[model samples]
Target: MASVTLTLLPGPDLLFVITQSVSQGKRDGIAVSLGLCSGLIVHTFAAAVGISALLYHSAVAFQLLKYAGAAYLLYLAWMSLKETGRSGLSATEPKRSFFSLYKRGILMNVLNPKVSIFFLAFLPQFISPAVGKIPLQMITLGGLFFVQALLIFSLVSVFSGMAGEKLLKKSMGSKSISYVKAAVYALLGVRLALLEK
Candidate 1:
Protein backbone atom coordinates (compact mmCIF):
# COMPACT_ATOMS: atom_id res chain seq x y z
CA MET A 1 0.00 0.00 0.00
CA ALA A 2 1.17 3.51 -0.76
CA SER A 3 2.15 5.51 2.30
CA VAL A 4 -0.50 7.87 3.64
CA THR A 5 0.49 11.16 5.20
CA LEU A 6 -1.00 13.17 8.08
CA THR A 7 -0.26 16.45 9.83
CA LEU A 8 -1.67 18.96 12.34
CA LEU A 9 -4.30 21.45 11.23
CA PRO A 10 -4.07 25.20 12.05
CA GLY A 11 -6.99 24.76 14.42
CA PRO A 12 -10.07 26.95 14.64
CA ASP A 13 -10.23 30.56 13.50
CA LEU A 14 -11.39 32.34 16.62
CA LEU A 15 -11.82 35.75 14.98
CA PHE A 16 -15.27 35.16 13.56
CA VAL A 17 -16.42 33.37 16.68
CA ILE A 18 -15.23 36.24 18.81
CA THR A 19 -16.92 38.78 16.55
CA GLN A 20 -20.22 36.93 16.74
CA SER A 21 -20.24 36.75 20.51
CA VAL A 22 -19.29 40.39 20.86
CA SER A 23 -22.63 41.50 19.47
CA GLN A 24 -24.76 39.76 22.06
CA GLY A 25 -25.91 41.32 25.35
CA LYS A 26 -23.39 41.08 28.23
CA ARG A 27 -25.05 38.92 30.89
CA ASP A 28 -25.86 36.35 28.26
CA GLY A 29 -22.77 36.83 26.11
CA ILE A 30 -20.27 34.63 27.91
CA ALA A 31 -22.90 31.96 28.34
CA VAL A 32 -23.56 31.89 24.65
CA SER A 33 -19.87 31.85 23.72
CA LEU A 34 -19.27 28.98 26.13
CA GLY A 35 -22.24 27.35 24.53
CA LEU A 36 -20.59 27.70 21.14
CA CYS A 37 -17.25 26.53 22.48
CA SER A 38 -18.93 23.47 23.92
CA GLY A 39 -20.18 22.61 20.48
CA LEU A 40 -16.72 23.18 19.00
CA ILE A 41 -15.31 20.61 21.45
CA VAL A 42 -17.71 18.01 20.11
CA HIS A 43 -16.94 18.98 16.54
CA THR A 44 -13.23 18.60 17.16
CA PHE A 45 -13.83 15.10 18.47
CA ALA A 46 -16.13 14.24 15.60
CA ALA A 47 -13.56 15.42 13.08
CA ALA A 48 -10.84 13.53 14.88
CA VAL A 49 -13.01 10.42 14.99
CA GLY A 50 -14.45 9.83 11.51
CA ILE A 51 -17.08 11.94 9.74
CA SER A 52 -14.99 15.02 9.03
CA ALA A 53 -11.97 12.84 8.47
CA LEU A 54 -13.54 10.96 5.61
CA LEU A 55 -15.02 14.09 4.18
CA TYR A 56 -11.59 15.69 4.02
CA HIS A 57 -10.17 12.77 2.05
CA SER A 58 -12.94 12.86 -0.51
CA ALA A 59 -12.64 15.64 -3.07
CA VAL A 60 -16.33 15.45 -3.92
CA ALA A 61 -17.32 15.66 -0.27
CA PHE A 62 -15.02 18.58 0.34
CA GLN A 63 -16.42 20.54 -2.59
CA LEU A 64 -19.96 19.91 -1.47
CA LEU A 65 -19.10 21.15 1.99
CA LYS A 66 -17.31 24.20 0.68
CA TYR A 67 -20.29 25.30 -1.33
CA ALA A 68 -22.55 24.78 1.64
CA GLY A 69 -20.27 26.85 3.85
CA ALA A 70 -20.16 29.60 1.28
CA ALA A 71 -23.93 29.69 1.09
CA TYR A 72 -24.25 29.85 4.86
CA LEU A 73 -21.74 32.64 4.96
CA LEU A 74 -23.78 34.54 2.41
CA TYR A 75 -26.88 34.09 4.49
CA LEU A 76 -25.04 35.43 7.50
CA ALA A 77 -23.93 38.40 5.44
CA TRP A 78 -27.48 39.18 4.46
CA MET A 79 -28.57 38.98 8.05
CA SER A 80 -25.80 41.30 9.11
CA LEU A 81 -26.75 43.82 6.46
CA LYS A 82 -30.35 43.85 7.54
CA GLU A 83 -29.65 43.89 11.23
CA THR A 84 -28.77 47.20 12.87
CA GLY A 85 -28.58 48.29 16.46
CA ARG A 86 -32.11 49.59 16.21
CA SER A 87 -33.55 46.12 16.29
CA GLY A 88 -30.76 44.12 17.92
CA LEU A 89 -30.40 46.47 20.87
CA SER A 90 -34.06 46.55 21.79
CA ALA A 91 -35.10 45.91 25.36
CA THR A 92 -36.23 42.33 24.69
CA GLU A 93 -33.98 39.40 25.59
CA PRO A 94 -33.40 36.32 23.46
CA LYS A 95 -36.19 33.85 23.95
CA ARG A 96 -33.98 30.88 23.18
CA SER A 97 -33.73 28.31 25.95
CA PHE A 98 -30.42 26.84 27.07
CA PHE A 99 -31.16 23.72 25.11
CA SER A 100 -31.80 25.84 22.06
CA LEU A 101 -28.57 27.73 22.57
CA TYR A 102 -26.67 24.47 22.89
CA LYS A 103 -28.37 23.09 19.83
CA ARG A 104 -27.64 26.27 17.94
CA GLY A 105 -23.98 26.01 18.80
CA ILE A 106 -23.79 22.44 17.59
CA LEU A 107 -25.60 23.15 14.37
CA MET A 108 -23.65 26.33 13.71
CA ASN A 109 -20.28 24.60 13.93
CA VAL A 110 -21.40 21.33 12.38
CA LEU A 111 -23.12 22.85 9.39
CA ASN A 112 -20.38 25.34 8.59
CA PRO A 113 -18.51 22.68 6.62
CA LYS A 114 -15.44 24.90 6.45
CA VAL A 115 -14.72 24.06 10.07
CA SER A 116 -14.69 20.31 9.51
CA ILE A 117 -12.60 20.55 6.40
CA PHE A 118 -10.27 22.99 8.10
CA PHE A 119 -9.67 20.42 10.80
CA LEU A 120 -8.99 17.73 8.23
CA ALA A 121 -6.46 19.92 6.46
CA PHE A 122 -4.97 21.37 9.59
CA LEU A 123 -4.85 18.56 12.14
CA PRO A 124 -2.71 16.35 9.95
CA GLN A 125 0.15 18.85 9.87
CA PHE A 126 1.02 18.11 13.51
CA ILE A 127 0.17 14.42 13.35
CA SER A 128 2.60 11.57 12.82
CA PRO A 129 0.72 8.55 11.57
CA ALA A 130 4.02 6.74 11.10
CA VAL A 131 4.63 7.12 14.81
CA GLY A 132 1.53 5.02 15.55
CA LYS A 133 -0.28 7.65 17.58
CA ILE A 134 -2.34 9.70 15.10
CA PRO A 135 -5.53 9.51 17.09
CA LEU A 136 -3.84 10.58 20.31
CA GLN A 137 -2.26 13.53 18.59
CA MET A 138 -5.51 14.56 16.97
CA ILE A 139 -7.27 14.50 20.31
CA THR A 140 -4.57 16.55 21.97
CA LEU A 141 -4.54 19.16 19.24
CA GLY A 142 -8.32 19.37 19.23
CA GLY A 143 -8.30 19.88 22.99
CA LEU A 144 -5.80 22.69 22.65
CA PHE A 145 -7.96 24.48 20.15
CA PHE A 146 -11.01 23.94 22.36
CA VAL A 147 -9.31 25.71 25.26
CA GLN A 148 -8.10 28.59 23.13
CA ALA A 149 -11.43 29.01 21.45
CA LEU A 150 -13.20 28.97 24.78
CA LEU A 151 -10.91 31.61 26.22
CA ILE A 152 -11.13 33.96 23.26
CA PHE A 153 -14.86 33.64 22.77
CA SER A 154 -15.51 34.04 26.49
CA LEU A 155 -13.58 37.29 26.56
CA VAL A 156 -15.34 38.53 23.46
CA SER A 157 -18.72 37.77 24.97
CA VAL A 158 -18.02 39.32 28.36
CA PHE A 159 -16.38 42.49 27.12
CA SER A 160 -18.34 43.12 23.94
CA GLY A 161 -21.73 42.24 25.33
CA MET A 162 -21.30 44.21 28.53
CA ALA A 163 -19.71 47.18 26.82
CA GLY A 164 -22.20 46.96 24.02
CA GLU A 165 -25.07 47.03 26.47
CA LYS A 166 -23.78 50.23 27.96
CA LEU A 167 -23.16 51.63 24.51
CA LEU A 168 -26.50 50.39 23.24
CA LYS A 169 -28.18 52.64 25.75
CA LYS A 170 -26.71 55.58 23.88
CA SER A 171 -27.86 56.10 20.32
CA MET A 172 -24.44 57.09 19.04
CA GLY A 173 -22.72 54.25 20.82
CA SER A 174 -25.32 51.76 19.62
CA LYS A 175 -24.86 52.89 16.05
CA SER A 176 -21.11 52.62 16.35
CA ILE A 177 -21.27 49.07 17.68
CA SER A 178 -23.78 47.99 15.05
CA TYR A 179 -21.69 49.50 12.27
CA VAL A 180 -18.58 47.66 13.41
CA LYS A 181 -20.44 44.41 13.75
CA ALA A 182 -22.05 44.79 10.40
CA ALA A 183 -18.72 45.46 8.77
CA VAL A 184 -17.07 42.53 10.49
CA TYR A 185 -19.78 40.06 9.57
CA ALA A 186 -19.98 41.24 5.99
CA LEU A 187 -16.22 41.15 5.65
CA LEU A 188 -16.04 37.64 7.09
CA GLY A 189 -18.79 36.50 4.81
CA VAL A 190 -16.91 37.89 1.85
CA ARG A 191 -13.75 36.21 2.97
CA LEU A 192 -15.56 32.90 3.32
CA ALA A 193 -16.91 33.33 -0.17
CA LEU A 194 -13.40 33.57 -1.55
CA LEU A 195 -12.21 30.48 0.30
CA GLU A 196 -11.34 27.43 -1.83
CA LYS A 197 -11.67 23.87 -0.68
Candidate 2:
Protein backbone atom coordinates (compact mmCIF):
# COMPACT_ATOMS: atom_id res chain seq x y z
CA MET A 1 0.00 0.00 0.00
CA ALA A 2 2.81 2.34 0.86
CA SER A 3 4.57 1.46 -2.36
CA VAL A 4 1.39 2.01 -4.32
CA THR A 5 0.85 5.37 -2.70
CA LEU A 6 4.37 6.42 -3.52
CA THR A 7 3.97 5.22 -7.08
CA LEU A 8 0.81 7.25 -7.34
CA LEU A 9 2.73 10.33 -6.42
CA PRO A 10 3.51 12.54 -9.45
CA GLY A 11 6.94 11.16 -10.26
CA PRO A 12 8.66 10.64 -13.56
CA ASP A 13 6.74 7.48 -14.40
CA LEU A 14 3.40 9.12 -13.71
CA LEU A 15 4.43 12.20 -15.62
CA PHE A 16 5.47 10.12 -18.59
CA VAL A 17 2.21 8.20 -18.56
CA ILE A 18 0.20 11.42 -18.39
CA THR A 19 2.12 12.89 -21.29
CA GLN A 20 1.53 9.79 -23.38
CA SER A 21 -2.13 9.76 -22.44
CA VAL A 22 -2.63 13.42 -23.23
CA SER A 23 -1.02 13.03 -26.65
CA GLN A 24 -1.84 9.49 -27.78
CA GLY A 25 -5.25 8.67 -26.22
CA LYS A 26 -6.42 6.04 -23.76
CA ARG A 27 -5.38 2.90 -25.65
CA ASP A 28 -1.82 3.98 -26.24
CA GLY A 29 -1.57 5.24 -22.69
CA ILE A 30 -2.66 1.84 -21.41
CA ALA A 31 -0.13 0.12 -23.64
CA VAL A 32 2.61 2.40 -22.39
CA SER A 33 1.54 1.74 -18.82
CA LEU A 34 1.79 -1.97 -19.45
CA GLY A 35 5.27 -1.58 -20.85
CA LEU A 36 6.32 0.41 -17.81
CA CYS A 37 4.88 -2.23 -15.51
CA SER A 38 6.69 -4.92 -17.46
CA GLY A 39 9.93 -3.14 -16.73
CA LEU A 40 8.97 -3.14 -13.06
CA ILE A 41 8.38 -6.90 -13.30
CA VAL A 42 11.92 -7.29 -14.59
CA HIS A 43 13.20 -5.19 -11.71
CA THR A 44 11.25 -7.26 -9.23
CA PHE A 45 12.76 -10.49 -10.52
CA ALA A 46 16.22 -8.97 -10.53
CA ALA A 47 15.76 -7.79 -6.95
CA ALA A 48 14.74 -11.26 -5.85
CA VAL A 49 17.72 -12.82 -7.63
CA GLY A 50 20.22 -10.20 -6.43
CA ILE A 51 20.91 -8.60 -9.82
CA SER A 52 19.51 -5.40 -8.44
CA ALA A 53 22.06 -5.58 -5.65
CA LEU A 54 24.79 -5.77 -8.27
CA LEU A 55 23.51 -2.57 -9.81
CA TYR A 56 23.23 -0.97 -6.41
CA HIS A 57 26.83 -1.65 -5.44
CA SER A 58 28.61 -1.23 -8.74
CA ALA A 59 29.32 2.45 -9.29
CA VAL A 60 30.44 1.94 -12.87
CA ALA A 61 27.32 0.05 -13.88
CA PHE A 62 25.13 2.56 -12.08
CA GLN A 63 26.75 5.51 -13.81
CA LEU A 64 26.47 3.86 -17.18
CA LEU A 65 22.78 3.18 -16.76
CA LYS A 66 22.04 6.67 -15.43
CA TYR A 67 23.67 8.33 -18.42
CA ALA A 68 22.01 5.92 -20.82
CA GLY A 69 18.63 6.76 -19.36
CA ALA A 70 19.33 10.46 -19.66
CA ALA A 71 20.48 10.09 -23.23
CA TYR A 72 17.35 8.16 -24.17
CA LEU A 73 15.12 10.86 -22.65
CA LEU A 74 17.01 13.54 -24.54
CA TYR A 75 16.58 11.56 -27.72
CA LEU A 76 12.87 11.36 -27.06
CA ALA A 77 12.74 15.11 -26.52
CA TRP A 78 14.50 15.70 -29.81
CA MET A 79 12.15 13.39 -31.65
CA SER A 80 9.10 15.02 -30.10
CA LEU A 81 10.32 18.49 -31.01
CA LYS A 82 11.36 17.45 -34.48
CA GLU A 83 7.92 16.02 -35.23
CA THR A 84 6.09 18.92 -33.61
CA GLY A 85 4.33 20.35 -36.66
CA ARG A 86 3.48 16.97 -38.14
CA SER A 87 2.47 15.29 -34.88
CA GLY A 88 -1.04 16.68 -35.09
CA LEU A 89 -1.23 17.03 -31.39
CA SER A 90 -4.71 18.39 -31.94
CA ALA A 91 -5.85 15.26 -33.74
CA THR A 92 -7.96 12.58 -32.11
CA GLU A 93 -5.27 9.95 -32.72
CA PRO A 94 -1.55 9.70 -32.21
CA LYS A 95 0.91 9.96 -35.06
CA ARG A 96 3.10 7.18 -33.68
CA SER A 97 2.17 3.50 -33.61
CA PHE A 98 1.07 1.67 -30.50
CA PHE A 99 4.11 -0.58 -30.63
CA SER A 100 6.40 2.42 -30.70
CA LEU A 101 4.73 3.92 -27.65
CA TYR A 102 4.93 0.60 -25.84
CA LYS A 103 8.59 0.16 -26.69
CA ARG A 104 9.37 3.70 -25.58
CA GLY A 105 7.67 3.03 -22.26
CA ILE A 106 9.77 -0.09 -21.74
CA LEU A 107 13.01 1.62 -22.68
CA MET A 108 12.27 4.61 -20.48
CA ASN A 109 11.75 2.52 -17.38
CA VAL A 110 14.36 -0.15 -18.05
CA LEU A 111 17.18 2.32 -18.53
CA ASN A 112 16.62 4.06 -15.20
CA PRO A 113 19.13 2.60 -12.75
CA LYS A 114 17.34 4.36 -9.89
CA VAL A 115 14.39 2.01 -10.25
CA SER A 116 16.59 -1.09 -9.89
CA ILE A 117 18.33 0.38 -6.91
CA PHE A 118 14.98 1.31 -5.42
CA PHE A 119 13.81 -2.29 -5.72
CA LEU A 120 16.96 -3.57 -4.06
CA ALA A 121 16.53 -1.22 -1.14
CA PHE A 122 12.76 -1.20 -0.83
CA LEU A 123 11.81 -4.88 -1.32
CA PRO A 124 14.29 -6.26 1.16
CA GLN A 125 12.85 -4.20 3.99
CA PHE A 126 9.56 -6.03 3.60
CA ILE A 127 11.16 -9.48 3.26
CA SER A 128 12.22 -11.56 6.21
CA PRO A 129 14.87 -14.29 6.42
CA ALA A 130 12.46 -16.25 8.65
CA VAL A 131 10.27 -16.66 5.60
CA GLY A 132 10.58 -20.01 3.82
CA LYS A 133 12.55 -18.29 1.07
CA ILE A 134 13.71 -14.70 0.71
CA PRO A 135 13.47 -14.73 -3.06
CA LEU A 136 9.90 -15.97 -3.06
CA GLN A 137 8.84 -13.39 -0.52
CA MET A 138 10.47 -10.61 -2.47
CA ILE A 139 8.75 -11.69 -5.63
CA THR A 140 5.38 -11.90 -3.95
CA LEU A 141 5.68 -8.43 -2.49
CA GLY A 142 6.96 -7.06 -5.74
CA GLY A 143 4.01 -8.59 -7.55
CA LEU A 144 1.70 -6.65 -5.24
CA PHE A 145 3.46 -3.45 -6.17
CA PHE A 146 3.14 -4.24 -9.86
CA VAL A 147 -0.59 -4.82 -9.58
CA GLN A 148 -1.14 -1.60 -7.69
CA ALA A 149 0.91 0.32 -10.17
CA LEU A 150 -1.06 -1.10 -13.09
CA LEU A 151 -4.40 -0.11 -11.64
CA ILE A 152 -3.31 3.39 -10.75
CA PHE A 153 -1.54 3.93 -14.05
CA SER A 154 -4.57 2.77 -15.99
CA LEU A 155 -6.79 5.20 -14.16
CA VAL A 156 -4.37 7.99 -14.97
CA SER A 157 -4.42 6.93 -18.61
CA VAL A 158 -8.19 7.09 -18.88
CA PHE A 159 -8.55 10.47 -17.24
CA SER A 160 -5.67 12.06 -19.09
CA GLY A 161 -6.96 10.75 -22.39
CA MET A 162 -10.30 12.30 -21.78
CA ALA A 163 -8.66 15.58 -20.93
CA GLY A 164 -6.63 15.32 -24.10
CA GLU A 165 -9.73 14.70 -26.16
CA LYS A 166 -11.31 17.87 -24.86
CA LEU A 167 -8.19 19.88 -25.60
CA LEU A 168 -7.99 18.49 -29.11
CA LYS A 169 -11.67 19.13 -29.73
CA LYS A 170 -11.27 22.71 -28.69
CA SER A 171 -8.13 22.95 -30.80
CA MET A 172 -6.74 25.07 -28.03
CA GLY A 173 -3.02 24.98 -27.21
CA SER A 174 -2.47 21.97 -29.47
CA LYS A 175 0.95 23.13 -30.56
CA SER A 176 1.75 23.92 -26.98
CA ILE A 177 1.23 20.32 -26.01
CA SER A 178 4.13 19.15 -28.13
CA TYR A 179 6.42 21.88 -26.85
CA VAL A 180 5.43 21.18 -23.26
CA LYS A 181 6.08 17.48 -23.69
CA ALA A 182 9.44 18.20 -25.24
CA ALA A 183 10.40 20.41 -22.34
CA VAL A 184 9.26 17.76 -19.89
CA TYR A 185 11.34 15.07 -21.58
CA ALA A 186 14.37 17.30 -21.66
CA LEU A 187 13.95 18.24 -18.01
CA LEU A 188 13.60 14.62 -16.98
CA GLY A 189 16.76 13.82 -18.88
CA VAL A 190 18.61 16.51 -16.98
CA ARG A 191 17.24 15.19 -13.71
CA LEU A 192 18.54 11.72 -14.49
CA ALA A 193 21.89 13.13 -15.47
CA LEU A 194 22.26 14.87 -12.12
CA LEU A 195 21.60 11.70 -10.12
CA GLU A 196 24.54 10.25 -8.16
CA LYS A 197 25.44 6.58 -7.91
Candidate 3:
Protein backbone atom coordinates (compact mmCIF):
# COMPACT_ATOMS: atom_id res chain seq x y z
CA MET A 1 0.00 0.00 0.00
CA ALA A 2 2.82 2.37 0.83
CA SER A 3 4.58 1.56 -2.41
CA VAL A 4 1.37 2.13 -4.37
CA THR A 5 0.83 5.48 -2.70
CA LEU A 6 4.40 6.54 -3.31
CA THR A 7 4.26 5.48 -6.96
CA LEU A 8 1.08 7.47 -7.45
CA LEU A 9 2.61 10.62 -6.00
CA PRO A 10 3.47 13.48 -8.40
CA GLY A 11 7.22 13.02 -8.39
CA PRO A 12 9.71 13.74 -11.14
CA ASP A 13 9.46 10.25 -12.59
CA LEU A 14 5.66 10.36 -12.69
CA LEU A 15 5.63 13.83 -14.21
CA PHE A 16 8.21 12.90 -16.81
CA VAL A 17 6.23 9.90 -17.92
CA ILE A 18 3.08 11.95 -18.15
CA THR A 19 4.74 14.65 -20.21
CA GLN A 20 6.14 12.10 -22.62
CA SER A 21 2.77 10.49 -22.97
CA VAL A 22 1.00 13.78 -23.51
CA SER A 23 3.46 15.05 -26.07
CA GLN A 24 4.72 11.99 -27.87
CA GLY A 25 2.36 9.00 -27.39
CA LYS A 26 1.73 5.89 -25.32
CA ARG A 27 4.52 3.81 -26.84
CA ASP A 28 7.13 6.37 -25.97
CA GLY A 29 5.79 6.71 -22.47
CA ILE A 30 6.00 2.95 -21.92
CA ALA A 31 9.55 2.90 -23.24
CA VAL A 32 10.55 5.61 -20.81
CA SER A 33 8.84 3.82 -17.95
CA LEU A 34 10.68 0.61 -18.76
CA GLY A 35 13.97 2.44 -18.78
CA LEU A 36 13.19 4.11 -15.48
CA CYS A 37 12.35 0.77 -13.90
CA SER A 38 15.48 -0.78 -15.35
CA GLY A 39 17.50 1.93 -13.65
CA LEU A 40 15.92 0.85 -10.38
CA ILE A 41 17.74 -2.46 -10.76
CA VAL A 42 20.98 -0.59 -10.18
CA HIS A 43 19.56 1.09 -7.08
CA THR A 44 18.31 -2.24 -5.80
CA PHE A 45 21.75 -3.75 -6.17
CA ALA A 46 23.38 -0.73 -4.56
CA ALA A 47 21.06 -0.94 -1.57
CA ALA A 48 21.62 -4.68 -1.21
CA VAL A 49 25.40 -4.25 -1.28
CA GLY A 50 25.37 -1.24 1.08
CA ILE A 51 26.69 1.13 -1.61
CA SER A 52 23.70 3.35 -1.13
CA ALA A 53 24.89 4.00 2.40
CA LEU A 54 28.06 5.49 0.97
CA LEU A 55 26.04 7.86 -1.20
CA TYR A 56 23.93 8.82 1.80
CA HIS A 57 27.01 9.61 3.92
CA SER A 58 29.11 11.35 1.24
CA ALA A 59 27.74 14.86 0.79
CA VAL A 60 30.08 15.59 -2.11
CA ALA A 61 28.97 12.56 -4.04
CA PHE A 62 25.34 13.40 -3.38
CA GLN A 63 25.79 16.99 -4.50
CA LEU A 64 27.61 16.02 -7.65
CA LEU A 65 24.84 13.63 -8.71
CA LYS A 66 22.12 16.10 -7.82
CA TYR A 67 23.75 18.81 -9.92
CA ALA A 68 24.22 16.48 -12.85
CA GLY A 69 20.54 15.57 -12.77
CA ALA A 70 19.56 19.21 -12.59
CA ALA A 71 21.78 20.09 -15.53
CA TYR A 72 20.35 17.30 -17.63
CA LEU A 73 16.83 18.43 -16.91
CA LEU A 74 17.72 21.98 -17.85
CA TYR A 75 19.18 20.72 -21.11
CA LEU A 76 15.96 18.88 -21.84
CA ALA A 77 14.00 22.04 -21.16
CA TRP A 78 16.16 23.97 -23.59
CA MET A 79 15.67 21.33 -26.24
CA SER A 80 11.90 21.41 -25.78
CA LEU A 81 11.90 25.18 -25.96
CA LYS A 82 13.88 25.05 -29.17
CA GLU A 83 11.21 22.89 -30.73
CA THR A 84 8.48 25.40 -29.96
CA GLY A 85 8.79 27.03 -33.39
CA ARG A 86 8.05 23.85 -35.26
CA SER A 87 4.55 23.44 -36.67
CA GLY A 88 2.20 21.00 -34.99
CA LEU A 89 3.09 17.35 -35.65
CA SER A 90 2.92 17.76 -39.40
CA ALA A 91 3.96 14.84 -41.59
CA THR A 92 7.37 16.51 -41.86
CA GLU A 93 7.95 16.40 -38.11
CA PRO A 94 10.38 13.70 -37.27
CA LYS A 95 9.29 11.31 -34.59
CA ARG A 96 11.68 10.78 -31.71
CA SER A 97 13.16 7.31 -31.54
CA PHE A 98 12.02 5.11 -28.69
CA PHE A 99 15.58 4.21 -27.81
CA SER A 100 16.47 7.85 -27.31
CA LEU A 101 13.57 8.42 -24.96
CA TYR A 102 14.38 5.18 -23.20
CA LYS A 103 17.96 6.30 -22.71
CA ARG A 104 16.76 9.65 -21.47
CA GLY A 105 14.60 7.96 -18.85
CA ILE A 106 17.49 5.77 -17.70
CA LEU A 107 19.85 8.70 -17.36
CA MET A 108 17.26 10.78 -15.56
CA ASN A 109 16.56 8.09 -12.98
CA VAL A 110 20.15 6.97 -12.47
CA LEU A 111 21.48 10.48 -11.99
CA ASN A 112 19.19 11.24 -9.05
CA PRO A 113 21.21 10.42 -5.90
CA LYS A 114 18.14 10.86 -3.74
CA VAL A 115 16.65 7.67 -5.18
CA SER A 116 19.51 5.52 -3.94
CA ILE A 117 19.34 7.16 -0.55
CA PHE A 118 15.60 6.60 -0.55
CA PHE A 119 16.07 2.93 -1.24
CA LEU A 120 18.71 2.72 1.45
CA ALA A 121 16.31 4.20 4.00
CA PHE A 122 13.09 2.58 2.82
CA LEU A 123 14.13 -1.01 2.10
CA PRO A 124 15.64 -1.85 5.46
CA GLN A 125 12.48 -1.10 7.35
CA PHE A 126 10.88 -4.31 6.07
CA ILE A 127 13.98 -6.41 6.57
CA SER A 128 14.50 -8.81 9.46
CA PRO A 129 17.79 -10.11 10.84
CA ALA A 130 16.22 -13.50 11.41
CA VAL A 131 15.54 -13.81 7.69
CA GLY A 132 19.29 -14.19 7.07
CA LYS A 133 20.92 -13.27 3.71
CA ILE A 134 19.82 -9.69 4.12
CA PRO A 135 20.86 -8.75 0.61
CA LEU A 136 18.51 -11.34 -0.84
CA GLN A 137 15.63 -9.98 1.20
CA MET A 138 16.34 -6.46 -0.01
CA ILE A 139 16.47 -7.64 -3.60
CA THR A 140 13.12 -9.38 -3.21
CA LEU A 141 11.50 -6.28 -1.79
CA GLY A 142 13.03 -4.13 -4.50
CA GLY A 143 11.61 -6.42 -7.15
CA LEU A 144 8.14 -5.99 -5.68
CA PHE A 145 8.53 -2.23 -5.67
CA PHE A 146 9.74 -2.25 -9.26
CA VAL A 147 6.80 -4.31 -10.45
CA GLN A 148 4.24 -2.12 -8.77
CA ALA A 149 5.86 1.07 -10.03
CA LEU A 150 5.97 -0.22 -13.59
CA LEU A 151 2.29 -1.15 -13.51
CA ILE A 152 1.23 2.22 -12.20
CA PHE A 153 3.42 4.16 -14.63
CA SER A 154 2.18 2.16 -17.58
CA LEU A 155 -1.45 2.84 -16.66
CA VAL A 156 -0.76 6.54 -16.40
CA SER A 157 0.94 6.46 -19.78
CA VAL A 158 -2.05 4.84 -21.48
CA PHE A 159 -4.61 7.23 -20.13
CA SER A 160 -2.48 10.31 -20.71
CA GLY A 161 -1.60 9.17 -24.21
CA MET A 162 -5.28 8.80 -25.12
CA ALA A 163 -5.97 12.29 -23.87
CA GLY A 164 -3.03 13.67 -25.83
CA GLU A 165 -4.28 12.08 -29.04
CA LYS A 166 -7.67 13.61 -28.49
CA LEU A 167 -6.16 17.01 -27.85
CA LEU A 168 -4.07 16.81 -30.98
CA LYS A 169 -7.10 15.86 -33.03
CA LYS A 170 -8.85 18.88 -31.62
CA SER A 171 -6.22 21.03 -33.42
CA MET A 172 -4.11 22.01 -30.46
CA GLY A 173 -1.01 23.81 -31.67
CA SER A 174 2.38 22.12 -31.28
CA LYS A 175 3.94 25.33 -29.99
CA SER A 176 1.60 25.36 -27.05
CA ILE A 177 2.44 21.78 -26.22
CA SER A 178 6.15 22.48 -26.49
CA TYR A 179 5.81 25.46 -24.17
CA VAL A 180 4.09 23.31 -21.58
CA LYS A 181 6.75 20.65 -21.84
CA ALA A 182 9.48 23.22 -21.51
CA ALA A 183 7.90 24.71 -18.41
CA VAL A 184 7.56 21.32 -16.77
CA TYR A 185 11.18 20.43 -17.45
CA ALA A 186 12.39 23.81 -16.25
CA LEU A 187 10.42 23.61 -13.04
CA LEU A 188 11.62 20.10 -12.34
CA GLY A 189 15.20 21.13 -13.04
CA VAL A 190 15.00 24.02 -10.61
CA ARG A 191 13.42 21.81 -8.00
CA LEU A 192 16.23 19.27 -8.39
CA ALA A 193 18.90 21.92 -8.37
CA LEU A 194 17.57 23.21 -5.06
CA LEU A 195 17.39 19.76 -3.47
CA GLU A 196 19.45 19.18 -0.31
CA LYS A 197 21.07 16.07 1.05
Q: Best-fitting candidate, measured by TM-score?
A: 3
Which residue pairs does candidate 2 place in steric collision?
Answer: none
lDDT of 1 by residue, 12-113 (tens): 234444445455564345555566667666667767788887876677776765666556555655665555645455656344465665554555456556
Best-fitting candidate, scored by lDDT:
3
lDDT, candidate 2, at 182: 86
Model 1 misplacement above 4 A: 1-13, 85-87, 93-98, 121-133
Worst 10 residues of 2 by lDDT: 86-95
lDDT of 3 by residue, 19-138 (tens): 888777788889999889888888999999989999998988889999999999999999988877774355777887889888998999999898998999899999998988899999
What clash count goes with each model?
11, 0, 0
Q: TM-scores, in order shown?
A: 0.69, 0.93, 0.95
Residues 1-197 of candidate 2 have per-residue lDDT tens digits of 78977898888899999987886678878988988988898899998998988998899999999999999999988877865665445354346687787888889999999999888888888877977799999889989998999899999999998987776665444566678778999999999999986
lDDT of 3 at 190: 91
What is the Å distance of residue 23 in model 2 from its true position? 1.2
